[model samples]
Target: MSVKFRPLADRVLVEPIKAETKTASGIIIPDTAKEKPQEGTVVAVGPGKKDEPTTVQVGDKVLYGKYSGSELKLDGKDYLIVKESDLLGILG
Candidate 1:
């Protein structure tokens, strides 16, 4: 509970949980385009924004829009930086 994210206002820098090896469409997406993918592992989390505080935590797996967030790489791993509003919902 002591951990925190460097969120800029309502924007949350999130790292989405990784996707399955095979996509839901049953297609294997190549690596290059996958760099800016919606799938990733949640490593860090931001505190929250005004009004609508972030309901997500560091370990929650979430599904975002196709062109949802800003993609980043940490330790050669891909991550997504999305606004708290961009998050659709927490996946079960």
Candidate 2:
């Protein structure tokens, strides 16, 4: 709600949405055992660059590659500002 990002052109400032749960070895993971969320809220989005343009929006839920992009910490929380091409897909 109070997100401020000065993303470079053609890039998006995202707080990857974190999943609340995890499962492994055919067992459910407890909250304590669950891994840190790889996904998070979309903090800020940059203006699309290039002629064709990117379709991602500021509030759109998106999926990015596991090892994609750089990581940054804001207000003690982690965030990523990757290129629009880095986003894997938008959540429906």
Candidate 3:
């Protein structure tokens, strides 16, 4: 998964990972009942703000706040555009 869209300064483009469909009890959860995933793969990144540079890279998998970004679609796929500060951490 790669995208040609590039983010401006301090902004990042993320491809959100879908939430789990099954619970621990083995119940199959429907899409309408599922929560939006907080984790995502970094698809594109901005250069930096004037003084502060973004720590995340394009390929990094990151955790962000649940309601952090604005949703957009590119090539029929969903993506989020969030500020670097909205990102919580990078996944190992």
Candidate 4:
């Protein structure tokens, strides 16, 4: 998972996790009805601001706001560049 792009100044590069396409009852969800996923894997992280180093690392699964980051596409893969503050929490 090597990326040519690197975030700067507290920004994080995240690869969004796709929303569930099927319900627990085996009902299939339509693409248009699917909600944007708030969970993602951290692909790249920027150095923290002065006196504060970034806590999240690459490959960390995290939760963020539904509309937190700017959308990006590289090599046909969707990504998000959000501020560290936009991230809600780290996922196990």
Please report the candidate that would top TM-score against the real structure: 4
lDDT of 3 at 51: 84
- When 2 and 4 are scored with lDDT, the better candidate is 4
Structural similarity to truth (TM-score) of each candidate: 0.62, 0.71, 0.91, 0.95
Task: Give lDDT tens digits, candidate 2, residues 2-52.
Answer: 665677677877886665564555666777775554454566766667675
Better of 3 and 4 by TM-score: 4
* Minimal lDDT window, size 10, model 4: 2-11
- Model 4 off-target regions past 4 Å? none
Cα lDDT listed for each candidate: 0.64, 0.72, 0.94, 0.96
Give me the overall lDDT of model 2: 0.72
lDDT of 1: 0.64
List of clashing residue pairs for candidate 3: none
Off by over 4 Å in 3: none
Error at 26, model 3, angstroms: 3.0
Candidate 4 structure quality by residue, lDDT tens digits, 1-92:
99899899899999999899999999999999999999999999999899989999999999999989899999999999999999999999
lDDT preference between candidates 1 and 4, better one: 4
Span of ten consecutive residues with least summed lDDT in model 2: 34-43
CA displacement after TM-score superposition, residue 48 of candidate 1 (Å): 2.0
Clashes (candidate 1): 3
State the number of backbone clashes in model 3: 0
Q: What is the full ranking by TM-score, best candidate first?
A: 4, 3, 2, 1
TM-score, prediction 4: 0.95
Q: Residue by residue across 1-92, what tens digits does model 3's lDDT show?
A: 66879899999999999889999999999999999899999999999989899899989999999999999999999999999999999999
Q: Which residue pairs show collisions in model 1?
A: 16-40, 17-40, 18-40
